[model samples]
Target: MTTTANTSHNIVFLDRDSLIANVRRPAFSHSWTEYGATAASEAAGRLAGASIAITNKVPLRADTLAQLPDLKMIAVAATGTDIIDLAACKERGIVVSNIRDYAYASLPEHTFALILALRRNLLAYRADVQAGQWQKSDKFCLFDYPITDLAGSKLGLLGYGALGHAVARLGRAFGMDILVHKRTPVEEEGIRSVSWDELLETSDVLSLHAPLNEQTRNIIGSTELARMKRSALLINTARGGLVDEAALAAALTTGIIAGAGFDVLVKEPPPEDNVLLNLHLPNFILTPHIAWASTQAMQILADQLVDNVEAFVANKPVNVVG
Candidate 1:
C-alpha cells in the first residue's frame, strides 16, 4: 500500500468522448487533461509527464510503456485488458485497473432484444411491408417466413459469468430452460451442465459470453455451425474473433443455422473487404457495438474509473489487473 506522496498527479485521459457518461471529478486535487481520441503515434507524447493514464481502446504497447517513466497507473474504462501489455506493465511496476460487471444489465437486455427481434421475424416482416407485401397479400397477415416464440425453448449459454447469469435469468422469465456448457466437462449439482457437443447440437438459442483468448478464438467455426439445429439462433455479444466471420456468413446464407445477432465484429470499422458487411441478410442482425454503451452502464463505468484512480492514489487500489 504505497500512498502517492505527491498531492497533485498529472492525469491524461486518452479517449474521453468514447464514453457518453457524466464523469465526476476526482476527490483529491490533480491536473486532468482529456482528448477525444489518441493515435498510436501520439500516445507516448501525450503521456510524457502523466502519472495516471485513462484509456478505453487505445493500445499501450511495450515500447510505448517503456518511454513513460512518469506513468504509475493505467485506468482502463472497459473490462477487457487485451489492448494493454499486462506483462510489460507488471515488469515496469505500473498498477493497472479495469472496469468490470458494469454491463451486467445492459448487455443482457441487448441480448434479449436481439433474440426477440430475430425470433419474431421483425426485420424480415418489416422488409416485406416496406416492399409492399401487405397491400398485395391475399390474406390478413404474411407468413412467408417462420416466426418462433421464446417460451419453452432451450437456451445454451457459454461462459456463465455475471453476464451469462443475467441472460439466463431473462431466459427463464421467458419460460426457457437454461443449459450451461461445460468448458471442462464437469457436472455441477442443481445446475445442468451439458457437453459442448450437446449444447451445439440441441439448443434452440445459443448465446456466447466467453472472453477471447487462444482457446476461445474461432471457437464457433464451420464445423460447429453445421452441428446446430437449423432453427437455432446464434447470439454473440462477446468478442468477434470467437467466431469465424466467413463461416458465419455462409451459415446464415445456406441455412446452416436460422439466424445470428451480433454486437461485435473481428475488426471495428471493418475493412471494405470484410465478408459480414456484404451479406445484407435480414436473418443476420448487426449492431454497432452498443450492447454495453447504454447510458446507465457508461455512467457506472465512468464512476468506477474515477474510483479506481482515487483508490490507487490512496494506496488501496481496487480492481487491479495483472
Candidate 2:
C-alpha cells in the first residue's frame, strides 16, 4: 500500500442510526463512507481500507481492530466507551475520542421526570383512574394512593458532576433542599456537602448520576437501601450497574423504600427472565435508556462528533479518550 499525504483519507461511520437525532457528517478533508447498519461479521471487510471509523454501540474489539491495518482513529458518538477495547487501541496506537457533557440538559430533565413521576405516584394514579376506581367511589377522589409534593423534600445527589449539579438546581428550583454526598471523605463543604450516610438516611428523594466502573458498580444495594427513609424515592438516570437490579427488585417488593425510577438496566434489552421485568409494582418505573436522547442534546452530540473527526484529520483532535 502507498501513502499519500494529499490523498483523501477514508472515513466510515458504522451504525449511524444509533444516534437518535440527525448527525451532520463532519467536514472531513477526506472521502467518507457511512453505513446506517454494520454487522460485527462485516466490520473488518467494510473497514479494510478505512483510515477512520466512527461507531456508537457497535463493538470494535481486538478481533475487529486486528483486521483494519489503515485504521488510525475511532470517534465514539457517545460518552461511554465500554463497548470499545481501550487497551487494544492504546497498544495499536489508535486514537479514540468520545463526546462529553452533551447530556447535561437531557439527562437532568429525564432524572427529574422519573423523580417527579415516582414521588407523585403518577403511574399508579393513572392506572387507578383508567380502571374506573374513581367512578366507583362515592367521594370526588380516592385516597387509595399516596401523593407527595417536591417542596421541602431533601434531594440526595449521589454524583456531583454536571448532570448532578443540574439536578440539584432543578430540585432547589422546586424548593427542595439539595444535599450532595461526597464521592470521597473530605471536610464538609458547609451546607452543600454531607456524609454518604447522612444523604442516604435523611433524603426524601435520592438520585444517582454516577458512572459505571469497578468502584462505583452496585453502589446502591440492599445495605444502602436499608439506610434510606422508608418514604424516600430512589432515582437512577446514570448507569445500570451502579445499582444491583435484583436487589432493587427485592427492595421494591419488600417495601424497603417507597418507590424507585431507573432509566437504564444492567442489560440494555434485559433478558425476559430478569426479575425487574416480572414486577408489575406501581412504584417501579423503568425507561429504555433514553435519558440522553433529547433533540437538543442529540444535535449537540452530532455537531461535536463532526468537530472531533475534523480535528483528528487536522492532527489537533479534541475529546480524545485514548
Candidate 3:
C-alpha cells in the first residue's frame, strides 16, 4: 500500500490515546501526525492540511467538517460511528470507515461476567464476608443473600447481531433457554422470536446488544422495567443511552428488578450528579465501557484501523459508512 508523502497526502490522528491498545505505526508512504489528545476547539486547527483524519470519540459535526477543506477521509478507530455526522460527511464527499466486529470476544465474556456476578450476588456476599459478618454467624455460612443459577433460566437478548449471537452461545453452554427479540414484529422460520413485551416479562436475564438510535434511545425506561419479573436481571453491555440511568437507579432502589449490570452509560465519565454514581446497591454493577477493550480486541481494532487508512489511500476503501 502506498502512503501519503510530503507532496502526496497528510494523515492526522485526532486522539491516539483512546485505543488503550498498542498500534504499530504503518509503513505507509504518507506523512502522518498524531495527537495523543485533542480538544473540541483544537479539532479544526489540528486537521489543517490533512487528507485523512482519524478519530475515536471526538465529534465531527457539520461545523467542524466545513473547516477542513483538504480532508478526504475519516477513519474511526472504534466500531460505533454515532459521534460522527455521517450526513455531513456525505454532503462534503468525505469518505468514512469504521472498525467492525473487533469486540466479538471481549464483549460476550464481559456480558457473562456481569450476569454471573448478579446471579450469585457476588459483590454483596463478598462485602458481607469482608465485614466479618460470616464470622459472627453461628452456622458455617449465612443465607442473607439470594443466589440464582443459569440452568433452566430463560435468556432474552435484544439486537440479535454478532455480539448477541455470541452471548446466546454462552447461554446455551450454561443450559439456559435463549430467546431473541426480532428487530421488528415480522416472524422468521428457524429463529425463536419473542415480542418486546413478552421478552421483558418472561426473561430471567435480559441482555442488550443493540446500537443507539432514535427508536432505541431510552428503550428500557420505567414502564419496561415494571414489566420485568421481580427476580429478573438486566444486563447492558451495549450503549448507555439504551437505558434511562435515572429510571434504572429508581428500579434498583425500589427492587423493581433483581439486579442490573452495565458497561456503558449515557455519558462517559458521567457528571457528578449522575444517579448511578451515588448508588451503592448490591444489586448493581457498573463498569466504565471496557467490555470491548480487551488487549486482543484492541489489537484487532488497531490493525484494522491501519488497514482502513491504507485502503482509503488506494482509493478502494473497505467498511465505508459514508
Candidate 4:
C-alpha cells in the first residue's frame, strides 16, 4: 500500500465497458482515466504513470509489470485473478485485490437456467416448433425430444466455495441428491463427498464451480466425457478452461453425453474457428460470460471494487489475492 508522499494517485481503468455498473470514485484524493476497451498491446502504454490500475479481463503479465515501476495496486473487477500474474506482483511488492462473492445469486440462477433448459430439452422442442413439427404432428404435442426430471437425479458439484454452496442449495430445492468432489473429506450434513471418478460416472447432472489454474484446467476432457452417462448434462458457469473445448465439441457431436451449457471459454470473444462456437447442436448452450452480469450483481461488484481501492488507500486492503 505504499505510495508517493503527498501525491494524488493516478488511477486508470482499462476496459471500463466490460462492466455495465456505475463505479463510484474512491474517497481519497485521486485522478481517474478510463477507456471503453483496451487491447493487450496497448496495456502498458495506457497504464503508464498509473499507480492504481483497474481491469476486468485484460491480462497483466510479468513482461507488462516490468515496465511499471510506480504501480502499487491492481484491483481486479472480477473474482478470477488468473489474468494477473500473482508471482510477478508478489516479487514486485504490488498488492492485488479482487471482487468476491458478489455473484452468489446471479451465477447459481444462471447455472440452473442452463440445467433446466438442457434437462427438459427446451431448445430442442423450440426448434421443433419453429420447424412446423408441432403443427404437422399427428398428436396434441410433439414427442421428438426426450425430457427428464431433475427431482430424483444426482447433482454433482466440483469446488464447494460460496457459489458452489448456492448451486447446491438450488439442487436440493429441486429434490436432487447432492454429490460434491473435494480434495479433503466433506463433513457437511446431507451432502455426499465422492471421489472424482465416482462423480464423473454417477452424476446425472454435473456442474463445475472451480477456478481455472494449473491443477484445474481441462479437468473435464475426452476421457471424463466418455465416462459420463449418455443422458447426463454438464453445466459450467465457472471458468472456461475447466473443460476442454475440442473434446466437448466431439462429445456433443457424437452423443457421448446428453448436453452441456457453458458461460465461459478459455478465450473470451472466442475465435471464429473455436470448436465449441462451430457446434450447432441444440443440446449445447453458450453464453457470452454473463452469468455474473445481472444488474444487481454488477452493482455489488462495482461497490466492492471501490471498497477494495479505498481500503488499500487506508493500508487495510480487503480481499487481497496475492
lDDT of 1 by residue, 1-322 (tens): 0123345898889988789988887898888888888887899999998999999989999999999999999999998888899999999999999998899899999999999999998998999999999999999999998888899999999888889888988998899988898566535433478989999998999999998887999999999999999999999998989999999999999999999999989988688888988889989899988999988999999999999999999999999998
Q: Write the per-residue lDDT of candidate 4 for residues 1-322, one digit (tens) a residue.
A: 2222334898989988989989887889898888888998899998999999999999999999999998999999999999999999999999999999999999999999999999889998998899899999899998788888999999999999999999999999999999999888779987999999999999999999988899999999999999999999999999999999999999999999999999999898999998898889899999999999999999999999999999998999999996
Each candidate structure's TM-score, on Cα atoms with residue i matched to residue i, is 0.94, 0.91, 0.95, 0.97
Residues 18-37, candidate 2, lDDT per residue (tens digit)? 78677665565576677778
Off by over 4 Å in 3: 1-7, 184-191
Off by over 4 Å in 2: 1-7, 184-191
Best candidate according to lDDT: 4
Q: Which residue segments of model 4 deviate by more than 4 Å? A: 1-7
As for lDDT, the candidate ahead, 2 or 3, is: 3
Question: What is the TM-score ranking, best to worst?
Answer: 4, 3, 1, 2
Per-residue lDDT tens digits for candidate 3, residues 239-315, read: 99999999999999999999999998898878988899778889999998999999999999999999998888887
Residue 244 in candidate 3 has what lDDT? 94
- Go through the candidates in order and give each one's C-alpha lDDT: 0.91, 0.85, 0.89, 0.93
lDDT at 73 for candidate 4? 98
When 1 and 2 are scored with lDDT, the better candidate is 1
